[model samples]
Target: MTQNLGGILLIRMTSLGDIILTLPAIRAIRQHFPLHRVTMLTSLEYIDLVSEIPYLDEIITLDRRGKEPAETIRVVRQLRQKKFDLVIDLHGKFRTRLLSGLSGGRQRIGSRRDIYPPNTHAIDDHFQLLSTIGIQANDKSLEFYVTEANQCFAQELLNEKLLLGDQVKVGIFPGARWDYKCWPADRFAEVADRIGKQYNAAILLFGGPAEADLVSQVRDSMQADPILFDTNLQIGQLAALISFCDQFVSNDTGPTHIAVALGIPTIVLFGATNHLKFGPLDPMHTVIRHGNSLDRSKGNDMMRLITTDEVWKIAEGKLNSLDK
Candidate 1:
């Protein structure tokens, strides 16, 4: 097949949730240009997760969090060498802006300009970029490729923790990157206990090393015994574990997005964030918002306004539906 374009470099050097949400549009771009190799320029920690994106031909990683000067120069130099045909900046941040300029692609597309479109989801923001180039982004589902090895690892960890039963495995992620976005850990524990007792389900706490303290807060507060997923599993393995969840309840965070992509009935607790823009893609999934919208300045206390009972009802409804 004669290639229409040399290659495409997609820049999305953001944190977990945003990066995961960008997948569908990225996939659309790859599908639009089947013959061209689609590459993603992302953070080093995200390399494993992005690698699972079958549509992407290659992944370029950088330590964006650490701000490594030499690494940036090396990556930038290599990107210039690749002589990309198109560069898409989904992050729309300063670093991605710089990369978009240095990419040397014939056409450079970015998600945002001076202001965003009046009302749109964050995912659509990426799709809007494709429209400019006459490509309609028809696919809007989140994508995550889980390997057999990763699945096996997840099962083994579950078994080791004695969570390999027919009982429902409710995965809970209590921490979000930002304080404003995180619901209280104690409330999550209360929800876990309610679900565990009401349905005879096993609570599964999912988080990283950084989230261990937060995880502890939830676990210790809970009356129910939860299988703590605080191990050093690779990003792929962690997602694989999430796949086993019957229903996931979480703060507005990356793992919540992962659970939603896996087709799990996920209930997201939203307060500081806008539910209209960042809520679940599917109607089947739930997002319990505060009575009113709040800004970051409103503080995390607003999240507490989202009652445990209200979220419990939504979660129980999902679990009951699963039984039916």
Candidate 2:
């Protein structure tokens, strides 16, 4: 049914990685309906990240911390003011469920649980939300657009370091919010040391302030010299740096999604979390899983398992085979 075109609202109040992964759907929506005003509901922290993305006409921030009913009601009221014709509930949470239900939108799309076998993959499951609107799924790749300004900024940084032309830069993301997802800092350092020595590539460590200690630990453990970018880099700078990277090795984090979306070859380490549901969807990316090191102490699930050697081999293979 060709519903009368009007404003579209997308509800995906997830972490940075999940939001990054949703860019394909955003692009598809924008391309499909060029004139429609497309808005997104996401975390307040990610406002800058979504701002750099071109397709969004408006972005509504929902601070998930202190998630009071009043805050949700305020969001609902704001959404009501927007007068969206369709609300695509990518989050499918109770909050989004309520907001979409009460926002007065004509079509409210959401996900179904049984579409794929358990742990199939998140992108596929996320696409299920599209099905509610009669939108058939296809093999659409993830999307990320790096503006020329960001690229210039990245290049300037590289140039200042005198490491610009013909040098391969690799990104390592040692931080995943979940402990099950993070490979050991020592293991990451070992792999980085080996790869850097073998390929003469500069390894740039990426993480946020919370992971500053982990970054320091990895840097201290590394035998090969590396550039530690552990401090908080804005989403644009991070995107720009990832674009410049010849390849990226990361845990199942947002930067991994960003790397894949930017068309960079990435090696992702997955544990605890279901790889089938959340694995990277790009051909240029490969996922390595080991025994579940994730335990309650680590702030991750205990059932999952993966080893360091397995991830090292995968990272080695992907980095070695990277297209120049």
Candidate 3:
């Protein structure tokens, strides 16, 4: 690999959590080559997500659905014109592989899909890519910047919902992208009631517009009225709302990653997916996995194995410690 420190391109097109987790690797890359122009290629939805990241110099988006070889060839020509000194494909897919190969960079780095194993912790997998450029990720912290605009928007929403002051707020995200990853909505309501009684806390329910039904079910099940923010808040505004909570609970989902990045005391519930690869990175955050001997990779059985009391106990400990 050449140490020219010219223009560099990094490719990663994935969901929110994976993108957030990739920040530490990007940080390491920036530190290793401080003067190099760092550019990222991602989906159109995430082009704005990295706007506040000081390390990344530019972002290019490739918006395509399904197979489009003509569009792919056009994108390849566009990438080649950038004249990257180095290209790293964090996403080891066919399209990315083609782009990396055709980018005409002196140095190219990527995972050989044949040799790489599956389900490794995403951060560690990214570090593997960084090893090519002589950078090791010793500081594995996730990154986020809550802008002033985000704060103002969240403040206005809280004011409308009467969620002001130094009140003890407990936030809950009761839905995951897959129903199998979600815990029972009624169980979440029960836990909210228990914690609400313990601290007279304001329960804040959060999720995307698609999860409104789940959020409603959780609120309806609760004896206390949990405050539900509108489902229309942008991602940054949502992060601001999560930052306001004293403690947060969520099923394994994208916004949970945002809450974790904001350094909120987040408790993540694990079920079908293995938490070893996707759990909270902060040492203080709690992840409650079902203790039963069920095969975690197989089905939706693990969510049921976790009792509401167990979650309440963890929530109680975090809440009571705050009282001190």
Candidate 4:
């Protein structure tokens, strides 16, 4: 709670969406401690993603997948050398907790999920941690900074694909990290076809290399020809491309949160997950859940329960609202 605190180290190791959700809190920390040296410790895979965020003074990334023991020791030594005055562990995992303890910070704070009610949004949960340090984060808005160069990259790709113009662009991401969280690909194609026919929107299919087959399935099943973006793109490139979309449709995945952070109008499909906790909180975004209850045991069946008509109706409403 002291204003004269030295270096502050914040840790959130892995997973893109979770890291994206923590941005508001990070911004709040920067605002609260403008004079202090604030550094973020994240996984190496997300360095490209977190690097663009202007809130942190420094970023330290670890190759979490490669060289396990050696990387851990190296990171521990690095943290100790920095001699952080305060260590805030946004990630409550054992590894982060251990690092926080070994960082030699005089004050240490870890996230306490029990302090808040069930189904609290991750952003609010993070703010609750900040409250412990007398840092009140009243403005909890997610942010992703896309540099002009990356924006130019996205524009060039759109121009090369002849996807430029005033026509509405709809981005469809038909892949989820978990199988149970994905709606059927055929259903996505049907929705894309309907949107293309009704709104005459340019369909932009997006996916990582791992989801190329899934993205292809949706594109192949669609009657309309969609611009494919299935190649491996850097996080900034992906965010820049997504920024061009007028409307985005995606499963429960990291890119969904990225779209939300970029202020795009997004429709997220959720299954076997707590939409209340992780779904977009802004009014511009829509979340369509499969069932009345949160039942992880239902598995992929929960996602299948979501009909094409259901999603189409919401998408129609959103597109119509855009006209107003």
- Top model by lDDT, which number? 4
Clash pairs detected, candidate 1: none
Least accurate stretch of 10 residues (summed lDDT) in model 3? 290-299
Candidate 4: tens digits of C-alpha lDDT, residues 35-152: 9999999999999988888988899988978698999999889989998999999998888899899889889999866667778888899999999999999887888889999999
Candidate 1 C-alpha lDDT tens digits along 1-324: 224778889998867778888888877877778888888899898888887888888999888666788888989898999999888898888878988898788878887745676457877777777788777887788877899999998888889888756879899988887888888888899999999999889888877657888888988999877888754668788899999889999988888888888888899888777776777779889988766655687748778788888998899888989863
Q: What is the TM-score of each candidate against the true structure?
A: 0.94, 0.88, 0.92, 0.97
Kindly give the stretch of ten consecutive residues in candidate 4 with the minimal lDDT sum. Answer: 290-299
What tens-digit string does per-residue lDDT give for candidate 2 at 176-231? 87665677788789878877887888888888768898898899999877876637
Q: Which portions of model 2 miss their true places by more than 4 Å?
A: 65-70, 112-116, 291-309, 322-324
Error of 1 at 280 (Å): 1.1
Q: Which segments of model 4 are wrong by more than 4 Å? A: 292-295
Candidate 3 — which residues are off by over 4 angstroms? 65-74, 112-120, 291-297
lDDT of 1 at 249: 92
Q: What's the C-alpha lDDT at position 292 in model 3?
A: 36
The per-residue C-alpha lDDT of model 1 at residue 218 equals 89
Q: How accurate locally, in lDDT, is each candidate?
A: 0.83, 0.77, 0.83, 0.89
